[model samples]
Target: MRTAIVGSVLLVAGAVAAVTGILPLSDLVELWDRVWPILLFVLAITVVTELAAAAGLFTVIAQHTARWGRGRAWTLWLLVALLATVSTIFLSLDTTAVLLTPVVVVLARHSGLDPLPFALTTVWLANTGSLLLPVSNLTNLLAQHAMGQPSPFEFAALMAAPAVVAIVVPLAVIFVLYRRSLLARYRTGEGVAVDDPVLFRWSAGVVAALVPLLVSGLPVWIPAVAAALVLGAVFLVRRRGVLRVGLLPWQLIVLASGLFLFIEALHAVGLGTVLAAVSGEGESPLALLRLAVTGMVGANAIDNLPAYLALEPSAESPLRLAALLIGVNAGPLITPWASLATLLWHQRLTSMGVEIRWGRYMLLGVVVAPLTVVLSTLALAAFA
Candidate 1:
């Protein structure tokens, strides 16, 4: 619903800008043509992730996670963090935010465990863990393309170290914060029931195939679309009745495309020039730090997509651009309004019977998010 409103607003605003001769229709068309792959990749990867989840893949993983924890809270936490981080990096943060959060929530409760640590792990990782892949976050896709299209491997190469630092810092932070709560664990008897073992195996196999294919540096959409089709075929053969049209990530696709159009419109009136000024020819560590701080604050203030769009034009080089990306990916954790993933995670948690104190969430984020943004950007500045 919000995506529709935002898309509609962008359409109207862009139309007005074009009519007033502030922007050319040709420019708009060119902009859309340049970034259209965002929609395709988002849809294809989302489909693949959703289909695999529907095939009971996530549930099976969650159950196995419980078994592996051996009634140890810290062990369960490490596993949960790993799961959320993996889901975020591979499937995009939204998949982890929307799909994995619920699974972890239920797993925590079913295992008679405190849920806050698990829940926080999911949401935190959903934001910070998205740095490692082109497909990991829509922001990364936009940043990757905006900076000039790099291959999948090249994109990951730049982020590989920062991504590690991003996850590691948060792991240490969360461990400190929740160490006491994490000490209790409950036995998950046997395992969560898996409904069709063969279908599960097939769906899991297709998902596993995605890692190599994406890292192959081929176009992400092609491999993602192929995987979705393969898993989708298995689902249809066995679980045909469960497929819903809503499984298509139309909102996300529209969100990505609409954000582009809106940002381009902003560029038409000289806003982009102002933003581009921030990127000057400074490549010093301090310059990177300042730029990242700007991005981090922008994301918390107006959300990361627009924030990235605003900051992107100023990123004078790939290195500084990569630095800005660290802020964009890791810095959005400070508020509910910071990223759509945080919002979605909040909504999911509330709906599933967890009462999140907004005040407290923000307070904790204030303490941790800036720290995360600084550490992550520093890692990028040093290693990337």
Candidate 2:
């Protein structure tokens, strides 16, 4: 409800800007051309994941992951990390934060392990691991369009170096910080119950197939829409009660839409020049570092999405763009509002009676986020 109200306010502000000539109608058309497909992909993918959750797909995976741990706490944490990484890489960070967090938290509790490490892994990996693919983050999708709609393989290749680094750094930090708890053993939990066996199998199959299709380079939305439609039909036939208007992710769509318009308006009014002045120029290591640091600061100060949009004009080349992505994607670990995924992860944890100390989270992030961003940006430069 708070998110919906925020979205409504932003949407109204964007509409007012357009009406008052703060944002030209001509640019509005161009923005729509670029963003409509991205919005559609978000809508479709959200529906797909929501229905899949309703069918118990992620719960089954968490159960299997816990069983695979065989009573070793470290192994279980690693498995959860792997699960969060894969979920973020394929399903988007929001999905990992929103859907996978609760499942893993419960998995850890059921197995008699502290849930903090597992919870931290999901939120951190959701941001860091999201550097891998276009479908992995909304920022990646925007960057894909900016980079001429590169094939998924091509995009992955460009990001491969930093993606590995972004994932490894926080993981290293988490391991060191939580070694005491992580190294301890836990009991193996029983299998999770599924209310409907047939629905679970079908949803699992659909998601399994959807993963490859997402990276098939078929304009993204096509595969996502098809998956959503299939899942919607399945739910309608098997359990119509789960199919509702709430599945559409209207709040997110509105928020993103307003962000697009407002950011574009800011750019039109010379936000680009100001950002470029601060971000500097060239692809030298120092120059890239400046832009990346600028993005990191902006992301932590505001939110990553707007920060990325505000600084994008300064990222004139592929390397600089990569640097900016490193900052905004891997560097948003410090604040609750730095990324929506972080907030969503917190909400899930709070709902599940998992308490997280924000002060501790911020302190750890202060150490981790910069280290990850700097190391990852250097990796990007080296790859370039």
Candidate 3:
């Protein structure tokens, strides 16, 4: 994973530089000038989640969730699903993918339940559940900046109903798909043993503060940077020895740089006109559907973040731009390479010795992503 991220960063940087004569400086400059706060918000959330994970916060929550299941697989499924959704919304889907996936897998295995449904629930929710907040998915931030929305809260106002639709559609579908397997519950033995109760509470408390911050209509970076700093200080006082530069997420920084550079190069070569051609510029249902389908397929083929960046310039209307992000954010379920969250979910499953067949995966995704996009787009259309 690290290798791929680094390699992509290097390749995009080298290729764009080779072609553009100075590494897409104009695009980078423009991106930094316009959207640097989004980058900081992304990085801060990454750091905050990583730090919280390091403090064993996610593990504690996972175990408690399993315990809350009380030996009922269905309840366990609901709780785990809720946890995954919450993690994706608050900590970012990357955290849900990288941290929450393994925890749920462990919980399922410990309870002698089939891990597939729980795992799928986590992975699917990681992408689909991220529509609620601007910081929930990087694409949300991109949508905010690229669409030039006047108020950050506008994303929530317009997307809240669609976010609900995005989450509920998959929840219903996946439950039916996994219901047979979820029968016959077993108790998760003693749940997880948390090491530091004080730090755990502190971590959870500070992290919870992010909710109010995000909805406060303040800048996206303010609450996140504040929360991350508080947690970093806690770690410094309690476990200062464990502090390392690794938590800074340099790879993500590089990835951001490469994405901007790549987009810059594309713009330089006039890809915007092509993207604009496909972007639905009207308020009609057909135009909205086109935007949703196109965004989903493009995201699955090329990854959502870059796909959003590539096509974002073409989205002129508020409703169209929001719909585009809905597709990219909620509809990346078809392929493993569709979203970073899905990719991270795949890596987590593979490490846990679970493999999902491509056919079955695509089959489910084909059903889920479209309905998610359609219902959510309709909701957005109504809201808009």
What's each prediction's clash count? 1, 0, 0
**Residue lDDT tens for model 3, 168-247:** 99989988987886766786676556577767777889877776676566876898899889998988898886678766
> 1 or 2: which has the higher lDDT?
2
* TM-score between model 1 and native: 0.81
Error of 2 at 322 (Å): 1.9
- The residue-by-residue lDDT of candidate 1 on 312-364, one tens digit each, is 86886888888888888888888676777786677667656998798988887
Q: What tens digits encode model 2's per-residue C-alpha lDDT throughout 1-384? A: 666676677778778888999989998898888778767876787677678778878777767778889888899888888888998998788768866886787788778888898899999999999998888988988888788788888889989999999999989999999999999987776677899998898888987887777666677788888988998888889999988886676766666676677777777788878988999999998898898889998888767888888888788777788889989999999987688788667766875689999999999999999999999989988886
lDDT per prediction? 0.78, 0.83, 0.76
Model 3, residue 234: C-alpha shift (Å): 6.4
Which candidate has the top score in lDDT?
2
For candidate 3, the 10 contiguous residues with the lowest summed lDDT are: 251-260
Say which prediction, candidate 2 or candidate 3, comes out ahead on lDDT.
2
Q: Where in model 2 is the C-alpha error above 4 Å?
A: 133-135, 141-158, 244-248, 343-363
lDDT-sorted candidate list, best first: 2, 1, 3
